[model samples]
Target: MINLKMILRIMGILSLIEAVLLLLCAGVSLIYGESIINDFLMVAAGSVIFGGLLLLMGKGASKQLNRRNGYLIVTLSWLLFSAIGMFPFLISGYVPRVVDAFFETMSGFTTTGATVIDNIESLPHGLLFWRSLTQWAGGLGIIFFTIAMLPLFGMGSMHLFSAEATGTSHERLHPRISITAKWIWYVYFGLTLALTLFLLLGGMNLFDSICHSFSTISTGGFSTKKASIAYYSSPYIEYVISIFMILSGINFTLFFYLAKGKPQKALLNEELKWFLKSIIVFTAIFTVTLTYTSPYGVGESFRKALFQVASLHTTTGLVSADYMVWTPFLWALLGVIMFLGASSGCTSGAIKSIRLLILGKMTKNEFKRMVHPNAVLPVKINKIAISPSTQSSVLLFILLYMIIFVASWLAMMAMGVGNVEAFGTVVSSMGSVGPGLGLCGPVHSWNCLPDGGKWLLSFLMLIGRLELFTVLLLFTPQFWKKR
Candidate 1:
């Protein structure tokens, strides 16, 4: 039922492209006089050789990718890419442990901002740039890259796109998926470029600005400095980053509509409304709490509250302040925000607010049904009644998400992680929210996590980014059944 040859062929091509990108990283190393150039080159060469063999062997194969094959390909592609992605770190001896390297690569590809490297400033600029680039690539999605550039896949593109695309809904801005992919990336690239320029103007070096821009637009939140945004202490820079993070979390499809003079459509979208409302409500609460209870001035409290709420809600994980030291109430508030994530169909990760909104409405309708059994009520989004199938799918997805989250949390606890740390890491990893509350908190890294915990969290990150069904379906017997 799955096209193995076609999957391998696409993987080969993707690997080859990744290898080429690594070579560019090697150039950066050389230009910056970094010592890891040879190591990077060696890894790049191996990628090319391995990919070349697959390409040659799978040459002339049919390009069509069915649904089953698409999921298999995406899952395997991420795994394979992570494997090869670890080579540079391995060869450079920067990361001696294979597990740590794999975890880092997984984080990059998943666009999860968690890191094992504690001394980020100690790493070379080239490696840092490559790290940021991986997130940028992963942010829009590797499948999207393939879809936009590799036209031969045609109908197969939808299969891969469905597996990789975020959100409970998918939209095609153009009739052709390839064209749609290009438009998404065009917006993605434009935002990244604009953010880079703004950061540079705000007094960041070209290298730091570019890296930060990549991370910001991707909503990946990897900082070159050890202190993150705190290192700069520049209000202007923080404001700019907050704006882009919020923008990056929004559905790019809406931007396209706005570009086409369909601003009303974006405004009328239920998800957008919920997104804005959530930010406003949370910001207000956080501001009130911080201003009244904390030592900071009202203005300072508002700034901190708004920044943290935006960061966590968008799942960007950029820390402008040490949130752990904040009041317990504020800490708990942020923890909840981690699960809220940003808009679907964007780079942000979590159980999207739209699904939650639908579930809420569905729950309310069910309650009403108890009083009037003969009456009919429909769950509506954007003023349209959702079909039964879509509603069922959303409900199933939420259940699966909860199961995965609980299981992950329990696993972490079993691994000897403290309750606070376990809950934070599991939820944050599953939500693709980088920082947690305790050991993996905003001020901390997962470098000290046990190997088992690192691997488990890595898997969770992958599943979360793909959304539950795409990854969980891989485990079902029916998924493997021949059609």
Candidate 2:
């Protein structure tokens, strides 16, 4: 049976943590001398009260959690965080509609980076900071963030980690899961700080540097300016963000190994090797295309190609130039990149590189088996044979991912969205990548979409951010049956 009381208690703790984050934004408001401080404070107060009530109701609950409780808790927690996270926007009249507020908040927490706001710079510094914070906090994951603290509260994090952690295999840098989380956070924080310093040196102000650093390290594309990185028009800024976006797309566990003086182990990762190779290949293709077709010279084309390829490949969604106006072939290539996504266990979303790596191996093995009916050919990754179950799981995941994409694409078209826009939006939403083709392109906000479309995309973002099965499994009838 599900551990209902324990789930409530844990959610209460999460709400309190969220309240603290809100207060930090309020502090930012104070620093900026913005009157929106009251809006943040009011929401923070509400979070505290709501959290307190949950704690009271969950008093004396058993601490034990099963797989069922873990999945349910993770899904509900995301919804709960989004529900509470929307209030500051609502109270401040920034995102006036309930659907708009929820969609924006969900996008922030999921690091999807889609926005409805036309004038991003007009928002107060505090709200912008909060918006970036949501992405940064969610970069690794919500449950993963509290793993270190979960043990302090007399709870084990194994089930939670199993349910919510990304990638096909969980890497353990340390024997203790909490220690592993801390080590990963150390890498995450260090990268964010390094990127911030680079942006500052590139002539960006401290606030913009910090905010963009948050978005970049999280592979989130929220910008403090209206025109995104294009507003700066600095080649140096573009290159720096491009490099950092690629770095952030790497699996955090690999960074841990490098940090621990095991450079060979990290360097030998097959997925990392393939991911880098893919970037170089895509960048080269883009550079050649833009160099010949556009007014940009080879150097400028290379710069733009590197930035755009790295951005979308990592699902960062920070646009240097609008890709929609590019050759149809180029934007189509970017759509494929968005679908492929970055390395697993990092900030970005979509079908991760590790899975793709496995899928490629599986396809190869199938062909080999066809050649020799009696011979056994096992799929391998990084020189280790992949289990049959894992191979099947990867295949099933890709199938379901495509199935949902088709279904959602049709649904969007039925909702009065144009064919091109509908296709782009569904792919973008399902992959948790910001910007779409046509009307919802990088230059435009998603405000043109109907309320129903926004809500549908919001659901897509949640499921995508949770890696498909975690959220989808909750809807299955068998998932609710007592074991």
Candidate 3:
């Protein structure tokens, strides 16, 4: 049987920690003299009470976690945390509808960068801050955060850490999973703080600066202004964001390597090299095309090309120019970028570059096999041959991803969205890339989406963020069967 007691204890602790964070938001409300302080207080109190009950009831539970309990805890933790996280928006009456509030909260936690809220500036400073904080929390992952800070999990922390951490490859910078989690958090925080300082220095107010920094580091594209980065109209702000978006998309494990004085090893990573190469290649193509095709100056064209490439490639989704209005070729270019996401083990979503790289190598070997017949040609990564099982897993993942995309596209079309819009929105949501090509394009928000469509896309956002397998594995009968 699963250790429900232990799972509940972990969830309870996480809830408690979340409630404490809510209180900090409440503190922000008090400082700003915002009318939503009462709302924050109410939400904080509710979280505390709910969390307190779980802690009290599960106090006698065992501390250890196994595979079953780890999956159960991680899945339930996100759902419950999202549910609790919605209270601020609900209580504040900023987003009165339960579905909309839940969608916003889920988007925030998933770092999906999609928003239903049409008027962002009208939201209270405290609520906005909480929204940004949710992205930061979800960016590093709440479960991993708990594993790092809470010591009660003991050796079992590895189970929870593996479940929460993105990517097929797990590299530990420290001997213990807890220490590894802490180190990653340290790097995440450092980057976020640095971005915030730069944004502040670039003429944004403290609130917008902090919020944008949170979103940037998370690769979550929630913006304080309606026009996003375009609202600033400052090339400096855009430049800072462009750089950080790329950085956020790279694997933090590589960051740990660089931090540990192994910059050469980090640079030698095949995925990182291919990732940069892809960016440069695509950026150059788009810049030249846009410059020649459009009336915009060379400098303006280059800026737009870099921003859009960085945005879609990193899955950051921050837009300065409306690609919908740009040449049709540029729009197609972004769609391609949307499908090829950031490096593995990072916060960015979609079919990761590492998987694609493996697939490319595998394809080449298969071609070689056809000609060589009996000769052995193994697929290699980092100068090491990949096992058949790993190759099988990557291929299967890609197949399933494509299947999901087609199904979602069909479903959205049936939901009354136009063919172009449906395909764009489905791919965007499923890839966690935020913007689509048509109605859901960079110039438009998902606000106009039907309720059914919003709910569908929200579910897709969660699925994509968890990487299809983790969430889909729950549906298997074997996953639920008794041991």
Candidate 4:
């Protein structure tokens, strides 16, 4: 019932591609003369051998995959990807521990930007490139990238696409899902390229520009320097990255609309409207808070607030300053934005804004329904009526997200972590918004977290990246029942 052969075959392909990406990183290491080249090659070789074996064993599985298979494969590939990707850190003795390496790689692939390494600058060029590369691959999603580029995966492409993509906000922009995938990728890569050029123009070096652009456009927060965006201390660079972070958080389809000269349609998108408004609202509030307390001038405070707010709003972990240094209230406010991540169809993680919009509408509709029992009232997003079933799913997702958040918080607290760290870590990790308050706040690495906390947060990153259902559904008895 599970399509084990098909799963293995597809996983093989995923691994092969992963190996190829690693080899590219190895090339960077070779050029930079980093000693980590051997670690990268060893893992790539292992990936190749294992992938070839899986392909050979599952030759019969080269068929169209069912919806169920898509879900399983997507979930399995993420797990396997993280599991294999950790080796460079482990084998190189950079991370030393399997759990630490796994946590780092998982955070990267999930684009969560949480790091266990205490000193990122000391890492060699190759390892740094690999670090940035993970987020780049993860930004749009590794499987999503595979489906778009590899024609062999055309069967069930939509199933894989839907299973892996975020939100129900937008459907295929193109009639053919593969075409839609390519178009989506064009926008993704185009944005990355444009952002790289912008950063280069802002005086960033080529390497930092490309690396930061990869993270920025993907909304993955991995930064090349220890101080993140703060390392540059250039207002121009900060503003450029801030703008792109906001742009990246937008649904990619909206870009497709703009490119197709449907700017009016894209501008009319309800989620886009809400997203822009939310950014403005958050930026204003955060700026006001900083202005009231921070020693910096009003303009500087607003700039800092805008950059940090955009970073957190998009779930990009790049920080312009140490947020923990801010007032506790402001720090808590950042946590709130972390919970309500960017637009649904983008890379940033969390409950997503579309659901928040839906929740707001649902709450208003409930009050209206209460006032007039017999009157017909419908909830609509972008003028399209939302069905009762869709509302139920959204409601359930929020409820489940909260439950898991609380459970993770409790679990971390139980592990002897402080309240602030536990709360911030759980919410940030569960939301896939790296950086939290107190000990785990901006400017803090996860090196201090206990082993259990690392593993727990790693799983949280995976589930958060998958948007919960794909991973959570595996535990349901119904998921295993054969039709």
Candidate 5:
């Protein structure tokens, strides 16, 4: 049975966390001397009151949480965060429409980076900080952040961690899950800080540096300027951001292992090998194609190709140039990279490198099986044999992912979106990558999309960010039955 009281208590605690985030934004507003401070303060005050009341209602809640409660809590926490997170935009009158505000906030929290706001630069500093902050918090995950920093969920932390963690497996760096969470977060924060310093060295102002750093490390592509990374027009900035994007795409567990003085573990990781090799191969192909086909020289082509390949491969979505004008083949190539995202257990979304690695090995074994019927070949990663259940789960996940992509594509087309735009938008949204093809391309905001289309894409972002099963399982009939 679902533990309603425990759920409420956790929700209340999460709401308080949201209030703290809002107040931090309000502090920014005050420093900037923006009148929007009132809006943030008001919404934050409301959050505190609401959270306190929920805490009161959950006063005698049980400490234990089952699997169902964990799933429900994780899903509902995201929904609740988005619901409350939208108010700042609404109250500021910056995003006037309810749907627009909700979509923007949802995009931020999901780190999908799709935006309806056309003039991002015109927003006050506070809103921009809040906008970027949401992605940073979300990139590592909100509950996971709580698990790392707070000891509130004493008994059922494992349930919460398992419910939200992506990829086929959840590996712990430390014996204690909370300690593992802390180590991973430490790596995440370290990357963010290092990237910010690099951006500053590239001549970006402090605010833009911090914001872009947050977005980059989160694999979120929200830019302070409408032109995105293109606005700077600096190869230095592009290269730095690209390098950090690739770094952020690495699994935090690998970073944890390195931090714990076990560099060999990360070096020998099969998924890491696949991911880096794929980036090198994709970047080389794109660079060669652009060099011969476009006006770019070899150096320019390499720079652009490396940045774009790294961005989309990590699902970061920060664009340095308009790839829409490039050869049509490049467009399709990027879509594939976006589909095969960077390493698992990091900020990136989409079908992860580990799953792709497993699938590739599985395919190879199939041919071997056909040639030698009696031979037993086990799929392995890091020299450890993968269980049959894991291999099957990976296959099923990819199948369902494609099925949903096709279904959503058709639905978007039926909503009056063009075929190419519909395809790009669906893939981009579902992959948590920003920028799409045709109308939804890099140069454009999603402001042109119909409200219904925005809502549909918003739903796609949520499920995609949560990894299909977490949110979808909530809709399953068996999820709610008492065990």
Candidate 6:
């Protein structure tokens, strides 16, 4: 059964945190000139009032929520958070249209980095801060953040955590979900602080450094400048972001192991090895291509190739240069890399590299089984046997992900968008990768997209952010009916 009261209570808590975040953004506005202070404050107050009322009504709600209720709450909370989060954009009149506002907010919160706002640099300081804050909170996840930080959620959080976390495994670094969340956040925070300091040394202003770190560590690509990382024109800054983006793409759990003084755990980790090797292999291919095909010097070509490969591999959509003008083959190569994102349990979206590795192993296992029937062959990762159910679920997820991507791509193309742009947008939004190619390229924005296309891609962003099953299950007949 769906625990409506529990859902409300949790949603209330989430909304209050969101309200507090908005207020923080409002404070940033106040620190600057006072132009958009009212806009942020009014929305923040609304969030507080709405959240407060929910809290009052939800007093005495049962805390024993089941898995089904958790899924429902997780999906609804993401929708509600995005809905409420978009208000600053709407109230401030910066994003006047509802569809546009929702898309921008959804992208930010999903860490999708797909933006409809073209004049990003012209936005007020408060709104820009709000934009980055959404990504920061979303980096680890909003519900995970609330459950881990706020003691209010308590032990009932596991269901919600399972519903939101990537992959099938719920392996815990600590016995309690809250403690696990704390350690995860500690790693996330440390990385952010370190990245910000490095960016400062790389010559970014305090504000830009902070905001870019938020987006970068989250694998989110929202930039204050229109040209993204190219605005500073600093190779130092580009390389720094590249390094952090790769780090952010690794499983946060690995960081926890390292902190706990378990070096071998990270070293022997299958996912980390795959992620690292793919980065090196992809970057090498790209470097060779750029070196031979592009007019840049050998060193410049290698630098560009390495940075872009890191960006694409991690699904961090920041652009140092316009790669769309690169050889068509390399353009296609990057698009394919977009499909295989970095490690699971990180902020990156798309079919994660871990899943890709699982898929490959499963395929090999199948071929091996063809040679010997009734053999007890199990897929193993790091010497641990993977459950059959996990392998099956991973396969199904990839299938469903492709299906949705294709359907959305068809819809966008039907709306008269260019074929390449439509395909890129579908993959980009579905994977939460920021910039698409051709029309929606890094140099361009999604402002020119038709309203219908915006709505479709926004739904894609939500589904992708929830890891597909959580959102898709809501549409199933079994989910809505009582057992």
Off by over 4 Å in 1: 152-155
Task: Give lDDT: candidate 4, residue 96.
Answer: 92
Number of backbone collisions per candidate, in order? Answer: 0, 0, 0, 0, 0, 0
What local distance difference test score does each model get? Answer: 0.86, 0.90, 0.84, 0.87, 0.91, 0.88
lDDT of 3 by residue, 1-483 (tens): 577667767777888888887888888889899988888788778887887888777777876777766777777877887899998898788899888888889888888778888788898889888888888888878988898866854436877876776465788887988888888888899999999999999999998998999988898888877788998898898889999999998989898888779999899999999999999999899889988988878888888888889988988888888788888888888888989999987788889899999999988888988999898888888888888988888899889989999898888888888988888887788777877878778767777778898888888887787788777778888888888
Question: Candidate order by TM-score, highest to lowest?
Answer: 2, 5, 4, 6, 1, 3
Tens-digit lDDT track of model 2 for 213-297: 9999999888898678988999999999999999999988888788779999899999999899999999999999999988899
**Model 4: per-residue Cα lDDT over 1-483, one tens digit each:** 788888888888988999998998899889888878888999999999999998887778757767777888888988888999999988888889999999999988999988999899988877888888899898888888877755655345767887798465447787777788778888889999999999989999998898999888877888888889999989999889889999999988888788889899899988888888999988888888888888987888888999999999889889999988888888878988889888877888998889999999989988988999887888899899988888988999999999999999999999999999999888888777888889888898988999999999999999999999988888889889998
Error of 1 at 415 (Å): 0.9
Error of 5 at 123 (Å): 0.8
Model 2 residue 127 lDDT score? 96
Candidate 5: minimum summed lDDT over ten consecutive residues — where? 147-156
Clashing pairs in 6: none
What are the TM-scores, per candidate, against the unseen true structure? Answer: 0.97, 0.99, 0.97, 0.98, 0.98, 0.98
lDDT of candidate 5 over 258-349, digit per residue (tens): 86799999999999999999999999999999999999999999999999999998989899999999999999998888798888899999
For 163-191, candidate 1 gives per-residue lDDT tens digits of 88745578888888989999998899999
| Per-residue error (Å), model 6, residue 454 | 0.5
Task: Identify the superior model by TM-score, candidate 1 or candidate 2.
Answer: 2
Reference-based lDDT, residue 214, model 6: 95
Query: Residue 445, candidate 1: how far off, in angstroms?
Result: 1.2
Model 3 residue 400 lDDT score:
91
